[model samples]
Target: MNQQALSAFIWSVADLLRGDYKQADYGKVILPFTVLRRIDCVLAPTKQAVLAEFEAKLAAGVNPDPFLFRKAGQTFYNTSKLDMRTLIGDPDNIAANLYAYIQGFSEDVRDIFERFEFATQIDRLAKAKLLYQVTEKFARVDLHPDKVSNMQMGQIFEELIRRFSELSNETAGEHFTPREVIRLMVNLLFVEDDDILSKPGVVRTIYDPTAGTGGMLSIADEYIIEHNDKARLVMNGQELNPESYAICKADMLIKGQDVSNITFGNTLSEDGHADAKFDYMLSNPPFGVEWKKVEKDIRAEHEQKGFNGRFGPGLPRVSDGSLLFLMHLISKMRPAADGGSRFAIVLNGSPLFTGGAGSGESEIRRYVLENDLLEAIIALPTDMFYNTAISTYVWVLSNRKPAHRKGKTQLIDGTLFWQKMRKSLGSKRKEIGDADIVTLTRLFGNFTEAQIATLFDANGKEVGRRMVHKGEFQPLPPEGGKIKLAPLSRIFPNDAFGYRTITVERPLRDEQGNIVVGTRGKAKGQPQADSALRDTENVPLSESVANYFAREVLPHAKDAWVDEEKTKVGYEIPFNRHFYVFQSPRPLEQIDSDLKQVTGRILQMIGELSA
Candidate 1:
């Protein structure tokens, strides 16, 4: 069946089950059924071949591994006594047959999911007859090997999870990272590096601490495969949520991914993979979640051997311990002893400049900044995710930066970037187009700062341009006078430069003893005439000389201003520096005579024209 028809059928099943369960809870039913159906479909074509091969080995008195019954290239395993065609061939005993089918799969595909947690939950399906109906409903539409590629199946799974996340809103932010956001993160982190793509058999491990659905890791894997045929990607992750953990494990199995290290349990409290490090790590941990209630052993382990020293600035605030996960990921960074690593994480704005002054969070920021490990921080637009519409940022950290980027951080204000997809879900939220993604990725790859611009004020005036320069203001002088220096600004509404203004207001007394005043004074504590302006009335004439003298005069003439008693005569170079204006070899007298003759000729020409 076409994708639309298939999706409509599956969504109907999920919709039916959703009435009895939470919106988020629908994934528990739909995801597993979808996985089983696909696996069964794939196995059906090869079922006879697999059984004959098993019988041949048995007849030869040679028993191969039972797990080989579901080999990588096989259509499906011959585990159940009744496959979809026979069980659904008669719908009465469908539930009982489906239960048997699942058991058969558990036994046949043991090695594939030997370490997964789904085995514990599969028994619960026996009580829910609706699940069998859903499975039978899924059976009607074939998701077989020839009908759907593994990637297409993955897409369907991702879309269902995304829809569930949208409908439920409970695990909306925690369970899924939007595909566009994941694409942007992957592009920005890898578009420039030839190291990951150019080398064949170069094993680069991709990891996520909270690998909800394993979308981020899988997408990155696909991206690498697209670029290089021989690129080897090893995906590893640690997930705390059981349903999502189970779904991720099932996905790897269907895709034929080696998920030896995809582990369950809280990554922060009891990391499932402590000794392993990765070359590329990407994640979107649950925002504003706390895990400080970790067991004392975990805390002691952290203090003794984990990231306590790295995050020693301060323990994160008790309410939201998001940074704890980031620190854990950083601790697992590929040591320089191994090949270097890079990481990209999506976070809210709080981490950028939160914690007030010198807070533990601030210390963390300071350490990261001073060490120059922060490569770039891209601020995504608002309402980009399915959950809360809070603004987010992508923090890109690299242990090995190119020489030019050392000791500096690139802050990409991508909040303004992105184009809305034609079929947008709602306001301030949209999918980024290919052009948008390309532009953003290129900007990130080139580390270009030219496109950076600032927002305007309430009046729409650009802040950077209109905000007065506070360096120093040069005060206007009286007619033909020298320029003067002004002090720094100390009040609002000061001139272009940050200066203080004082208004003077005085009353005029009338002859009748009534005050008819024209009020005036320096605008509140304005400076009296500056003492440096020795004589305010004696203004300098030459403009250039005035400018030069204002800048160069004071420091050079500090000790030269010898005051004898009250009236002092300065015996320094008082010659006007303006003489250089006429210092040419040709005299002005000859030039003026020539100008007079030319003026006479012009006057004669005007008289002739009048006549």
Candidate 2:
């Protein structure tokens, strides 16, 4: 059956959950069962062979673990004599049989169900008189790889989880990211290393700190395989949510990956793969969420490790932990001498320009840009997430910058590159289409300044749109029509986003207009600063601070001097300000003419009314 039909069939099992299970509790029953059935079907093809191998090895007094894995041709296998079909035949002992079936699986697979709290669910279902019926319903569906490709199955899994999270009023976005967004990120992550990735037998590691059901890792793996079948990716991820972790582990198991690589815990508090560095990474950490729970641990690391740990760069405010994940990914990058690493992370607008100078957020941005780690920032369309309708950006950072990209950052305005979905899911009303993905990917790959020209006809309807690169001829509209040009892709030196926030202080003057000078310490012979007259000015990093002070500050305040001690370097990508296009207002004559015409029309209408 197709994915939609399969998903619908599986979701229909909720019918048995009605009354006994609240809408919120339906997922506890459906999610684990779906995973169980999928695993059962996957192992069904070689079940007998695996069982025979296990028994033969056991009789021969040899360890059967290796033989069993080989026979099953998968990372996991089951030694139980019963399958889903057999469990249905004995309804009177269905609970015991089901428990046995679950216990028969390998340790890794068993761990997945344990985290799902499957035993409790089984007991709950049995107590409600729905265990046998639910088991039979799930057993009837075919989730074999042949019937449903891994990609299709992943989609079905995400869809079901999304529905369950929505019904339960949980944050669905924390569990999964939209596939299109992941695709675009994967594309950008690999775009610069196409040659190396396409090589035969190229093996690389990809990680996600906030794995969220392993969607990002799965997509990146699929992308590499699709491009070069011989290429291999070792996927590693860590997740905090129990259910998401279980699902991610199951996915890794089915894909023949070492499920141990996918850890369960808070990444910030504990580093699952402490000494591990990866070739690439992708993450969509919980956006705008606070890190207060792990503040002590994170701060301890920042203070004690100081440039030696993941969060050594800085820690954002307790209110938003998005930057902490970025720092974590930065620490995971393989060093440039060792082939380096590239990663893409989805972040809300806050990270782009959140805190001011010396603040945690600003320090994080300063660290990334000053070190030339940022490659690009793509502004995605708003309302693209399932939980929130706020603007988001995909930040691409890399330590192994190609010669063409070094010391330069590209900003692609992709806010308009979306199509309205036929059906909205939660807060998500738009989707990045395949064509939109291609366009954005091309812009990043090209790494050039370009503008999007929208051609309008004489009547002002949009006729066509085209992307024009710098130094290229602009596309013009038809006769008597106008063309609107906006920056679609722009490139800037890394320092363009950097600025020096200088504290400008003015001397305190007495009522008689005499300057007040400090008599002791550091200010011994210097003029005392007036707190009321103190102000700060942000000067672009591209310009000399001294020159800027002379040109802009001196003219306004002759006595204002830069307080060097209080000066702090900061970086912020004001994405909108750089691409803002200003349009002049209509002339007074035009406005007067329009007003006169409106007045005449109103007079004519009033005259007609009198008649």
Candidate 3:
């Protein structure tokens, strides 16, 4: 059966769980069992050989780990002769047999069940007199990789998790990101390194700090293998959610990756991969979530380690810790001398311009832009995630920028690139199509300014639309119609988003219009600035502060002077403002005519009523 059908079949087990298990608790039973069956089917072909190897090695008084792994052709093996089919044969002894089957697996696979707390679930099911039925239901489904590919199985897992999360009133997005989103991130992460990545036997490391179900890592691995069969991606990540961690580790195990690479813990407070650096990384951190829970640990690191730690640039306000993950990934980047690193993170619009000059958010932005590490930020369509419908942006950062990309950052307006989904899943009503993904990837790869133009006919119907590179001639508008243009892609120097906030002060004046002289030591006989008139102006980094104050502020306030001591460098990427397109409003005459037509019809109706 197909993935959707298989997922449906597995979800059917919930029918047996309804009265005994709360709707929210269905996943506690379903997810682990589904994983168990998948693993069971994977080892089925080699089960006999692995069991034989186990016996042969034990007889020789040698360790059987290597022999069993070789025999199973996987990182794990099951030693018990009781498969799910056989365990269900004896209805009364199913629970005891099921425990034995679970115990037969290697330590790694056994750990997965332990995290799932499968024993507790087993007892609960048996108490409800539902264990045998549930086990039998799962056993009937065929989840072999040959029948349902690994990619399909991954989708099935995510779908189940999404349903469970929704039922439990939890954010489904926390468990996994949409596949298309992961695909786009993977494409952006590897787009610029095609030459090196395409080389045969190319090996690289990919990590995700907020791994969820390892969607980002899995998709990246799939992307590399698709481009070059011999290319290999070693995946690693850390997750805070126990269930997600278990599922992610199981996924890696099934794909033959070392499950130990996926660690369980809060990435912010306890980094699982503290000693490792990766070549590529991707993450979609929880939006606007508070870091108050881990504030003590994070603040300690910032205060004690300073720049030697991940959060040294600056700490965002406790209300939103999305920037913390960005800083963490920044710290994990492989040095440019060691082939460097590229990463993409999904964030809300706040990080672009959340705090003012010298504030934590702005300082972080300043650090990134000043270092020329930000490569691009692509605005995604609203209603794209599973939980929240707010607009999001994907930031692509790299330390080893090419000559063409050095000192430059690209802003891609991809908000119009999504297609409506057939059915809404949570808050996700839109998805980026394969063609749109290609279009976006190409725009970033080209690294040039471009505009998307839409031509409309006389009836106001859209005739056509196409992307045109900067300096390229625009296509003529439809005859007797008009064309509208907006920036689809734009490139700017890193300094473009940076500015200096200069405090402007005006001298205090007395009632007689004389300068009010200060009586203090340093300010003796000098005019004191009026506190009420004090103002701040943001001077673009490209412009001299003195020149800007003279031309803009001084003209308006003749006695104004800049407070050099208060000058603070800040950065903000007003993404929408840069891509904004102005359109003149319709003429007053047109509005008047339309109103008159409606008024005349109303009068005729009144006259008919009078008659």
lDDT digits (tens) for residues 1-611 of candidate 2: 88889899999998878999899888898889989999999999999999899889989999999889999999899999999999999999999999999999999999999999999999998998899999999999988988888888889988998888888777525778999999999999998787646799888999999997888999999899888899999999999988889989998999999989999999999989898999999999987888899999999999999999998878888998889999999999999999999999999899999889898899899899889999999999998988888889999999999899999999999998999999998999999999999999999998999999999999999998998999999976789899999999999999998899999999999999988998999889899999999999999988999999999999989988988999998889999998899999999999999999999999999999999
lDDT of 1 at 18: 55
**How do these models rank on lDDT, best leading?**
3, 2, 1
Question: Regarding lDDT, does 1 or 3 come out ahead?
Answer: 3
User: Tens digits of per-residue lDDT for model 1 on 8-108?
Assistant: 67888865675566666676677766776777777776676666666666678886445344542532255445776677776666666665666666442
Candidates 1 and 2: which is better by TM-score?
A: 2
Off by over 4 Å in 3: 510-513, 604-611
Q: Once all C-alphas are superposed, what RMSD does model 3 give against the true structure? A: 1.4
Task: Supply every candidate's count of residue pairs whose N, Cα or C atoms clash at under 3 angstroms.
Answer: 18, 0, 0
TM-score of 1: 0.68
Top model number, TM-score: 3
* Candidate 1 minimal-lDDT segment of 10 residues: 492-501
Report how far off residue 332 is in candidate 2 (Å). Answer: 0.7
lDDT of 3 by residue, 1-611 (tens): 87778889999999999999999999999999999999999999999999999988999999999989999999999999999999889998999999999999999999999989999999999999999999999889888899988888889888998989888888525777899988998899888897546788788889999998888888898888888889899999999987888889988999999888999999999999986899999999998889999999999999999999999999999999999999999999999999999999999999999999999999999999989999999999999988889989999999999999999999999999999999999999999999999999999999989999999998999998989998999999988989999999999999999999999888898899888988989889977989999999999999998788888987788888887889999999999999999998899999999999999999999999999
> What are the lDDT scores of the predictions, listed in order?
0.62, 0.92, 0.92
C-alpha lDDT of candidate 3 relative to the true structure: 0.92
